[model samples]
Target: MGVQWSDAADGPIGGDLTAVLAYATPAGGAVLTPIAPIGLRDRDAGRLTFTTSLGFGRKLDRIRSNPAIALAYHDRAHGFGASSAYVLVQGRATIVERPDREYLETVVGPAAARFLGAPRRGPFWDRWLAAYYADRVPVHVDIERVVTWPDLRCAGDPVVDGEPLPAGPPASQAPPKKGAVPRVDVAKGARRLRGMSDLLLGYPGADGRPWVVPVGLRADDPRGYELSAAPGLLHPGARRAGLVGHRYNAQLVGLAMRQHTGWLEVADDGSARYAPHTDAGFAAPANKTLLLLTNGFLARRGLKQAQRARAAEAAT
Candidate 1:
């Protein structure tokens, strides 16, 4: 409840600016990438559309091979204590190349109206989007399933083709998670992952949507943990990366909050095992000391940055 916006009006979709499109790769892993939808939250219809270049992108290939995809959005403006409200949309997408004037005016027109501050006339925004839309495509994601955390009251069920989609387990339900990734609290999750020297980040690539690339995570004060991906793996408009070492590291803190039960134990032989809460002899002490040292380093770095900025201003 960081900022008060009626759930009935906005639902859990957040604003147009706050969403990530996720699709499965040929290898079965998932890549969560950001997207800006042009349409308003249509809870009843259970469908929303986004505008993207129809160029030779990895997502386009994945969609052509498999239309089943998911979009996850969380309102970062507001915070619900440790957790944030989020929505997961599982759907099929249809990409229309060289979309006609009629479809843009009728479908994506009204959605673009608010941002452009103009009516849905083809000549206006159509030409504007043309520069990017030329040979590009508009992907209309048909919502087959919609899941939200901290469910809020809405006007109607998310419907598809005149029928309401079946409800899913509440987001709070942990469910049976596979893998050795031990669940941890949202706050400590990223910090713990930052301790790892080498981790893998999955994003869309020529190989597949969830192409895995190794990365190193280091914590910095004021900025939190910073992730550096492999060379050429990071590019503009494709900043989001999924943690590969374990799914428990959690995604962006603002997206979904997780609960932790125990931590992972790494042996001298490089073998890793989940440590129960009762096991207190492992690296708990060393881990705590390391985290404190990292925090101190970050604080010093922040101070240095601030001093440099001040020095530049004085010189000017």
Candidate 2:
């Protein structure tokens, strides 16, 4: 139904900026975006609306900060002309709340009820969430301002000067994840393990904290990675400590993790539980690892061709 483009602003530090899924609150009188092109509408004259495929709660903070937004859409009709990478689109953005059943249905389609966090065919089957937001809102980003590539100097435009957005207080990564972490990132680590088909895990402790321990893994295409292990990967301390915990692993579980990040841990009884890591990359003293033999064995039974090779080496 619509096209999406990358967010051009990369923050003062200039890293890959994560695009936001939000809209401005009309009542709040935030940075107002137009509802139509060429100043067709006046200030607060029209509404801006857009969406991020995430939950309303997840995007609230961003919208609070940068109510003035620009959207990127693709002109599928126009080709990139070979030498170009990808096409672009731009528009003023805002978030809107949908109160009517008919309207929300039009925007969200058949599963509208579900995404509104509604359940089907239950005692409250027909009911929709009354007010499901700590903020209680849905974003409506209207397409008003249109800026495209060449216009913004092909998106290579640089910020002349601006104050930095103060970093938010670093929140704890997880009090503890009750369910599961994103398997997508795990798939990424798994692919890296495939390449090191000849190495075994090396650590100081047998077990301290469990995490996704990536020593030096980076590759393309991540999928099917679990928190399991390889053989001979355990340190003397880890070997002894692991006996106390359950499976104490997930597929190629990270080892000796310190604080929280994104990882899962299994208990000794073949029950895999999730534990969060605190640090960013795979850290040590409390880094994660594969009991060389353990990881190898699991790989042979659970992983495919590439992991099998790594597993084979671990067996030794």
Candidate 3:
């Protein structure tokens, strides 16, 4: 059975500006990325939607191959939501690769404006952001399960609504070819992420779908940060994993985020540690104009690169 969103789940699901999206990697790990889930596309069916640029070809490709994904709504410091509940939605994604312009302008545009303000117009802006605005794809998730905690901290026992979770972690895939050694200074990376308000850890679950949960740093080890989450949330074993730490102001006008992909070790006693192999992050400008400019520039560059890559593939 699908999850039926209760009033408690509705607040954050319908009003939060951003949610942490986790999608499976071919190597059997999960990559955590933050996305703006504009709003619930269908309340009764529990259909959630978000859009990404055509420029993000690699992520789009991953979703196309493995549709199972998860979204965690763990932050409530901004936007219209008033609920304190932390919600996690696990489902299958259906990507709308070439939605018509009318749908983009009428359906997606209005919902975006509610949270991001009106889109920039004029000939110069339009020409500058053509790819960013016009070349987008929407991904809709059909909710299979919903897990909620009483508050953002996930302090109380979770109340699950919908399908039952699998009994254990999924069969492990082949280990990544490369070694999982930390690529950056573990201590430096931990210090930078420790202050963020929302920290999430994600890994592949029993159904081969990604499972995400809010976690905190239990201790700072020389190799990595020890992780603490609700009891039974962390499966016992080592696996490829991802961690994201983020914070944002009202309407997502200002933000700082850090993401890392690495190896996670969970002991039989439930202790966990994450050693980051790679780290990447950014701080979005507080000024909307500057942010839009940055987005436009990046989108244009990414689109061009994607096109070139596609052309090269065809030439072979």
TM-score of each: 0.42, 0.26, 0.93
Candidate 3: tens digits of C-alpha lDDT, residues 1-316: 3458788988888888999999988778889998888775586776888999988788888899999999998877666899999988888999997787898889999998898788899998998888788898889899888888898877767788788778666554445577655667888888889768889999988877688988898777667888998777788888899999998776576778999998888888878888888898988898878788888898899888889988999999
Determine which window of 10 residues in candidate 1 has minimal summed lDDT: 275-284
lDDT of each: 0.42, 0.26, 0.84
Evaluation by lDDT, superior candidate among 1 and 2: 1
- Please give the RMSD to the true structure for each candidate, in Å: 18.0, 21.3, 1.9
Candidate 1 C-alpha lDDT tens digits along 1-316? 0112235324445353435566665534455444446444445555566766533355566677777766655433322122334455556787775688676666566555443334323664454434333333578667655544442221222222222332321111122245323333333555555443324443333323223333455432322234453233333321223452222111111222111223222233322232211111112122433433332343445445645765788999
Q: Which residue pairs clash in candidate 3?
A: none
Ranking by lDDT: 3, 1, 2
What range of 10 consecutive residues in model 3 has the weakest lDDT sum? 167-176
Per residue, candidate 2 scores C-alpha lDDT tens digits across 70-151 of: 3222111111122221111123345454344554455433322322223234333222222221112345543333223332
Compared with the true structure, the alpha-carbon lDDT of candidate 1 equals 0.42
Candidate that would win on lDDT: 3
